[model samples]
Target: MDVVIAPDEQIGEIVADDIAALIAARPDAVLGLATGSSPLRIYDAVAERVARKQLSLARARGFMLDEYVGLPPGHPCRYSTVIDEDFVSRVDFAPGAVRGPDGDAADLTAACTDYEESIGEAGGVDLQILGIGTDGHIAFNEPGSSLASRTRVKTLTAQTRADNARFFGGDIDAVPRHCVTQGLGTIMDARRIVLVATGDAKAEAIAHLVEGPVSARWPATVLQHHRRVTVLVDDAAASRLELADYYRHAHAHRHLVS
Candidate 1:
């Protein structure tokens, strides 16, 4: 695990820098996209780079991390539409280059199987962007989720619904109770992973994710087994990390890393 503590405003740029470099080296690099407020800045940075001709995603393909089940097509909150508005609309990705699980599928099990197969056929994700929940979940894989699970439908925990209520006009009741998400085992398949987090609400989760033991209780902890994972967090989020000082020192001396 490589933890890099940066200012709240800069974390996105740092992640974006790595992404831009990847696209420059491999224009068609597959990206695993995450939703929610945590990744907005990164999207902005990538879009700006495209606007400035410093970067282009015309050939890149993206796969979203999760989607809310039963949301009507064109629903603003749907992950597919959200990804379109949040990132795809601002860049030059080819039409139909991005995909998300079919949250409205009549046969959700088949949908999950096809989604997984699609990812494998794309040669798997080159780099995955992720966000940690206040409760330490990643991609809606709530506490107690199987460590070896794959893409599938999951019941949203009450905590997750409440946390996401803001997106549904602050009405927790309006938040969907079910979602389809990539499992921890599936996320671990990515060649590289970049997780972003911020704010005091995420402090404890960030701490556990970076320094705690790997366990199903904290789904994001599963990433500890991934070979290449970079965790980018702001000061507030890193406040509870026991080795914050060491992480900062290592980041400062990152040039020494081969």
Candidate 2:
């Protein structure tokens, strides 16, 4: 794991530059997408690169990390629609280039299985972007999610629903109570992972994920076992990390040592 501490604005550019390099190396690289506020800055930076003709996602494919169950088709808050509005629409990805779990399938279990199979058939994700919840959840895998779990349906905890209420007009009741998400085990399979966190609100979760034990209580900690993972956090998010100085020095001199 490589921990990078930088200003919030610089983190996005750093992540975007890495993604652009990946696309340059493999035009068909499969990207795992994450929704919510954390990744929006990265998307904005990437979109700017695409607009400037410095990058292209025309042949790239994408997979969303999770989707809310029971949301009507085309719902703005739905992950599928949100991904389109936020990122895909800004790029040149072909029709059907991005896929998400079927939240409304008659048999959600089968949907989860098929979604997993689809990812495998696409050669798996080359890079996955993630955001940690205020409660330490990744995707919809709230606290207590199995570390080796695969794609499956999960009930949204009260805290998760409350946290997501802002997207549903601040009415917690309006938020979906269930979702289909890639499990910790599934996320671990990605060839590389990049998780971004910002602000003081995420400081504790970032600390636990970076320094705490690898337990199901904080699913993001599972990244500790991934061979290729990069955690990009702003100063506020890295505030609680005990080895802050070491991380900063390591990043600053990584080229010389590596």
Candidate 3:
């Protein structure tokens, strides 16, 4: 994975905006989207572009990475709510262009299969935006999750629930124990993937993911093996990275070449 250490959070947003622009230029772009505080700023940047009439989502499709099971579709914590509050309702994408696993499905396995099939029929994702959990998980694919998994339901670990508690009235117990997520195999199918992180809370995970060996224990580390992965980090998140200078130098070299 190539790393871009932005000077600050706003720079990171600009970097993310550029990535969105690149996706917009594709013939038929399918986007894999993540929701969390880490991605909010980038979403804001993209929304700004749309508001300014600098970009359009007319030809784009979005697929959410995961959704908390058992929540009503209108629940504030639902992925559908996030897409609506963050991007969908604000953008000009056509009806049905934004897709995700059904949180209230009576048969979750069937729901997952349907979600996977729809993504496949659409020709797979062109760009995926990700947010790394402090525990090194991506899209709720918790530690030790199988790399070849398909879309399915999984139990949320205590730490994950606690981490997400703030969104559920700051009560960890209120957070759903289960969520449906696209598998690692599915995520890796995207033509390009962007993982964004900020804050010192993510330092250890970032260090392990960028420098440590690829293992399911830290699912995001698998991106290190993918040729088209790009990791954007703020200074705090990059603090534990030993190869920070190497990344900066490489980015500088690329800038010069262009």
Candidate 4:
């Protein structure tokens, strides 16, 4: 994993630079999109690039990380809707180019299977954007999720519901109790992964994800096993990392070696 400690305002540009480069090389690159506060800046940066005519997502495709189960059609909180409001609508992605697992399908198992097949048929994701939960969960794959799991429905942990309550007007009861999410195994197949975190609230999770031993209890730690992963964090989020100085030194010298 390549750890990048950048200022909160600048991390988005750093990640966007990489994505822009990828899109330049592969105009039809498939992207794994994550919703929530962590990736808003990335989307904003990408949108800015499109406005400047420096980038275009006209032929790109996207797969969302997860979708809340039982949300009514057109519900603002639905992951699909959220993705559209947050990122897709602001860019140039072709119509119907983004897809997510069906959270309200009559046969959820079949939906999960189909979603995984769709990703495989698209030649897999070129890059996946990720955000870690305060409890270390990734894409609703809470603690104890199978390390090699695939796309599937998962019960939302109480803490997860509570954390997401803010999006539902601070009412925990309003949040969905289940979701369909891409599994760790599915995320691992992406050619590259970019995980972002910020603020003091994420410090502990960042510490475990970067320095702690790989364990199911902290699902983000699984990134340690991926062949290509980039972790971007602000100073506040990197507070708990014990090897902070070393990470800084390594990042500073990486350009020299390359």
How high a TM-score does candidate 1 get? 0.98
Runs of candidate 1 with Cα error greater than 4 angstroms are 255-258
93-160, model 1: which lDDT tens digit per residue? Answer: 99999999999999999999999999999999999999999889999899999999999999999999
Residues 77-178 of candidate 3: C-alpha lDDT, one tens digit per residue: 898898788878877778889998997999999999999999999999888889999889999899999888889999999999999999889999889999
Score candidate 4 by lDDT: 0.95
Which 10 consecutive residues of model 4 have the lowest summed lDDT?
Answer: 249-258
Error of 3 at 13 (Å): 3.8
**Clashing residue pair totals per candidate (backbone < 3 A):** 0, 0, 0, 0
Candidate lDDT values, in order: 0.93, 0.95, 0.86, 0.95
- Estimate TM-scores for all models: 0.98, 0.98, 0.95, 0.98
What C-alpha lDDT, on a 0 to 100 scale, does residue 110 get in candidate 3?
93
Candidate 2 residue-wise lDDT, 71-172, digit = tens? 878998999999999999998899999999999999999999999999999999999999999888888899999999999999999989998999999999
lDDT of 1: 0.93
Off by over 4 Å in 2: 256-258
Residue 120 error, candidate 3, Å: 0.6
